[model samples]
Target: MLTRLLACTIAFAAPLAALAQTPPQVSPAVEASAPLEARIGELAQILAGKGDYDAYFAPAFRSQIPKEKFAQINAQIAATAGPMIRIESITPRTPWVADVTIGFRDAIGTVRISVAATEPHQVDGLLFSGLTPRVADMGSVRAAIAALPGRTGFALARLADGAPQMLLADHGDTPLAIGSAFKLVILAELVRAVNAGERRWGDMVTLDGGPLPGGQYMNVPAGTKVTLRELAQKMISISDNSATDILLKHLGRDRVEAMLAVVGIADPKGMTPFPGTLEIFKLKGVPGLADRYLALDPAGRRQFLDGEVARTPIAAISPTLFRDGKPVRIEQLEWFATPTDLIRVMDWLRRNSAAGPGAEVRAILGLNPGIPQPAAAKWKWAGYKGGSEPGVMHMTLLLEGKDGSWYALSSSWNNPAAPVEDVRFAGLVGRAAELAAPQP
Candidate 1:
């Protein structure tokens, strides 16, 4: 659910009638201010439509953001929440800064807009807050899933019962490619190993120069020593590919598979010898490799993967392969897990939370909260992990509400023809989360 779109500027818009109820912080002087109010209103209309507002931006803002960048940001907003419907209210925070409440087709939120007090009145800053969209009821949530551009599967289940109360299942039980989200499974295995005394949290391991290229620790030279716990932190918090591969190498693939079995993952054979980021790149970079590999039966595919891993050196992989090479057929090259299987993983983590390693794992997962949720403070704790590659997107969350209720929301979307819309999909997930626990 964490995406680049969250960083986009969100401004305020409100109906004129609603301005009377606006916070008293705005003096009558500011409300009656002729040109500034009109200009801000004009800015909102320009943003809602496709009009360019480069002339209205402060010199610093214009220099910091290019025209193309603004276009992309506007396009993302339009795709996710539709055009701004109206401004709900505007509260002046300072002579130059004000908070605006804006309504969108699917959501209502507040944004702080700051304008320089100058002749042209250029906008200097914009920030969003409390932008909670209306939660779709169960039926609407299902309809939305069915309306996605590609195949989609989702489940909302309480961790207490481990059963999906609401589900939009288009082959929901079948495992699909889930990119770095596979690291959750590895983290689970690592926690189990630590709990069993097979490995110590502080145990030091020397990097074999096998760390992959997609994340932090990539710059750490070969043979550098670091603690197992620190490596696990990087692996989950940042989806660090290098940290993951190093841990995978340390633990051996068999143990990871065993952990899957131990946790009762619905389909164990569907993912065996879990391919590290490097291995995935090696197969994906070669033309027709994924198709050929996937065409084989499961055993044959596993054998082929093993053979490829044995032959390929981590150093030989071009760092630019994932960025510049053809998009890998994610349906074949990445991790596979059904929504139910992921729910089971969440259940395991919750049931085991009192254990030392369990607590540690949850702590690490909580390190990155993923997308921001409205009324997040109402939850005792929340942990999230998401994964994406061209044509594949997945997100899973474990939350414990203040009322002692536990819930898990796991969803995935796939389209082999194009990249999934990150912002729109994230909004859907946010709606689903809100439905799971409504604000008091």
Candidate 2:
């Protein structure tokens, strides 16, 4: 079931938004033609139904995504979000592309369709993003955020020229525990280094660290050689702890810190030596470690970490050891970021990051496309990265609309007394996405 969900979510390959120097503009007559509308309707019906939809697809698209693959995707969607109920709306963006809103029994979603504008219109590209219909209402978003079980922070911004317009915010400037979402900082730093010619993505690095039990590649031998690009993919895609630590070690703490400083992160001290999953687990596992670590100042904590690293091995600790401990000092040990600060980071990445590294980042983030992204059709491209531990949950998204505008949405939920309810938090974030959707 989980495998099918992942397959359905990550099935779509993002289309190149621009291929030619200037795309031919759609004329008003062509835009208003009944035939084009009928074609879109027919395609949507075929896609929403269970039977083979190959007749509607272009030869190239058919070859790329075969009949069996389409069936699997359909089945996965049904199993995960239920069958499609209706087609709410279809808006043509270009002669070749249209934004579609699809309703499922469980939720509403958007599908972006691009077709070859030839004799027989055929699908050239297809992408799905889950979205809620309430996204356009700021009051709805505010109500959702207010109803969350624990302390919550969120920021939604429209990425237009100059400054971002904040649509909704609740404690947006306050730093909170952001779990593995901090990986974005590492990714940004790596991209910066790559852009500056300090490192190549293909550079092979040996994975020499002790095995961390929390994520993928744990069973692989320590000395296995892999490209920096592969490590970055695993780190962001699966939240692979070993991959993160390896990349961090290769990039060095100083470089990441410098990157943070340049980005003007709010809580620089909280991230100086970002803790690997294993290190965090070890700290949680060792009795009395949390209290002692929290009692110290930043410098003292750094000294404590050095001692702990020297004294302990990851294999000796278990991730579940501190599960029973309530109100742990997660804020002090784990990564922290405010929604505003995170939005700034996303803005920088969207505007300044090079094309190659930016594409890679988006691909990695698009791997786990589970979050509800209400009004998904308005977005031309969407990528997401989220993180969670016992008491911390965080989500961040970078999105581009069909109109050539960009946006960023970030939110965090934290509760020291108990684990934050995952469903509730995700639902709220989804509502927030609805509010951040592009205005018609």
Candidate 3:
């Protein structure tokens, strides 16, 4: 066993002696001072001395990035990581090399990165062996949008592209009353009736009374015969409540309610064509009213007045004394609705592709364009309806940004106890609408 071990050792010694006999030459000064170029030399060694270059370079990409992404980053680093990069740090104090660091900007954003690499001898520079860029964040844009007061209440949803979009919301899924905005529904029903051979677009309807005060119904003269199409246009574009009521009567409240129900709206107040109980009160001869208020049942009437229906309360005194000698008062009725309901009605119009400009709610709201364009440039469509009774002043609007994004806005002022100018509330509505409108 000893003889065998000796023979094996002698064989190893022979190979060692041959290698020593032809020792390679190296500069003494280069060997002595190479530590100064530590960071640069380490990188040079990696590029030139490593047998498996990938094995040495692979760790630089120790990230969850996809292979393609890694390759892209690698290419970008190779092209931009010049001597501006330097050895930022290193673990064990390497005798011959410093650490590596890099800084660069690309299509994405700027990046300042550090890694342990060797120092460059050619130009007193550091060679980067590892490189990476900083990731960009979009939180600022989201914060800016959220911070905007007018934007705070909007509910966000993702678009097809995974981009955030918004919708005006009021808690649950209640249908908006839209006041005369409901005229679009009337218009839609009229068109449907015409299409179904039930009526003609040019069919004439006679008005038995003059327009109500502050109502669009006054636009046409009493006893004047007008085509259905004419009434619809006036009712919708001008938000004529009288025209709306008249049209609603013609279309039948039941039909409208049924249509709304089909669209997933559960609010009976919103789905109802008119407050049936409230309509019944007007029929009871209380004064300051019309026959339209008689459409509701007692329970429905009570339900309508519940706090959930509207933020504003019914007026103590009625706005009018009679509707064609039919007595009525707002206080006698129990139903209430808010401007938010009005906007929801507009949404329904758009979703159902009902009548209005382009038969879509977006076209009616005129907000999709963010700014009011010229009539020739799409008219900045908008859905607007205003309501007033004694101290009650209310308006609801749905505006669309130029990109078809929408905003629902409602404003109401109930100061029956202290009486405010109706015009003031109207001005507020306009202002809120303007504020809610999207801008480029």
Candidate 4:
């Protein structure tokens, strides 16, 4: 499952979402002469690390995503999703746009691609979301996640009149570290503020400070004007830390903390003194700061983040803190939430995103439906948010089942002693999500 280049498909104008988003699955169906269908073979070669980049893509596609960057995205997919095996299906939306199901050694995946109508028929764009493991039902998915090392949790719930009817769960009440997934709270706060008339989606704010890694906003000049909608859109769609921190600051840190209870965090005190993105880097960068901060009660940590940690120079925060590609105080330093807690959070967003500037909330979440085709087709409407760190992995979704009922799936995996494999975790989560049955 590949997720970074999704926004690049068609006319890639917006900042892309996360780099590791994966989508859904389905049966085999091949069209012999659908125009764009012929290009699928070339895509297979490219994804398998053997295709010709210059010949398979148009200037427009090549210009936005350099050959090297394109290759890297494919390498990342192979690293996680395993090597490509074959094509399962190609369902064309148009001669230009189509959803193609692909088989990988570890999982089955669906990808969206757009091709040029003229000439050699080069690729215009492509979006890779996620992968679903070859499984018979949710039971197998739950078992696999349970067998994983360290802390792991999964929940399948049906939303009935604003409440969760637990359909299946494993460690559903245990809170685990959720990396960028914390942006959901920030989004909920933004919606609440807009609904209260405190701010408008059109409100523009000068981007504060420097951009951090893992985001396009990292390269954007500080102080560049950006709108609430743009920031929020980038935040969830790509889990942009820079956008998240700016929105967190603009909304007021304390207000966001207060929103925990409003959004059903279970234990609001667990996340009190919520730290912004920069604050997190500083906490990890400073020698022994994480252990000290973790040792303190929520109130004390808040004070440190507001005072000593707040004043820490940006230069002191080294990107090297995470360079080793290993967990760095994840348990003591990341956003905490349980499986059921996430269900409530998604429910809040689902019920409230129907009107006003808040109306755009749904679109933002669905900008990249972390799951693709056959599995994706299970829901009439779908939205996803996930987070990852060295030892922490999370995939959470808000889905409207085909019966017009709503459902939420929250899955998490954390290893305190080592790193968790991305592709394996994605396959497990994707299966449970695909098996979502609302009425039961």
Task: Report the lDDT of model 4 for residue 266.
Answer: 91
When 1 and 4 are scored with lDDT, the better candidate is 4
Candidate 2 pairs with clashing backbones: 130-373, 131-373, 131-374, 132-374, 135-434, 135-435
Q: TM-score ranking from best to worst?
A: 4, 1, 2, 3
lDDT for position 10 in model 4: 12
The reply for model 1, stretches above 4 Å from the true place, is 1-70, 85-103, 108-132, 161-171, 295-303, 313-327, 438-440
Q: Where is the poorest 10-residue window by lDDT in model 3?
A: 10-19
lDDT of 4 at 90: 72
User: How many residue-pair clashes does candidate 2 contain?
Assistant: 6
lDDT per residue for candidate 1 within 277-361, as digits (tens), equals 7667667655556677777886776687778655765545444553421345666667788876787787776666667755687
lDDT (10s digit) by residue, model 4, range 1-440: 01122112111112112332333233255333455877886777788668888888889888877887677667657765788889987776665767778998877876778788888878887766557777787778889899998999998888877478888889999989887778899999999988889989899998665434335565667778989999888888777766777788889889998889999899876577888777777787777677788888878888888888877776665546644557877777778899889988998998888777688899889876666455667778879888876788888889987788888999889998987766567666767777874543
Worst 10 residues of 1 by lDDT: 9-18
**Clashing pairs counted in every model:** 6, 6, 52, 12
For all predicted structures, in order, the TM-scores are: 0.73, 0.68, 0.42, 0.81
Q: Which parts of model 4 have CA positions greater than 4 angstroms off?
A: 1-39, 43-83, 92-98, 113-127, 208-216, 219-223, 438-440
**Candidate 2, poorest ten consecutive residues by summed lDDT:** 11-20
What TM-score does structure 1 among the candidates reach? 0.73
Report lDDT (CA) for all predictions. Answer: 0.65, 0.65, 0.37, 0.75
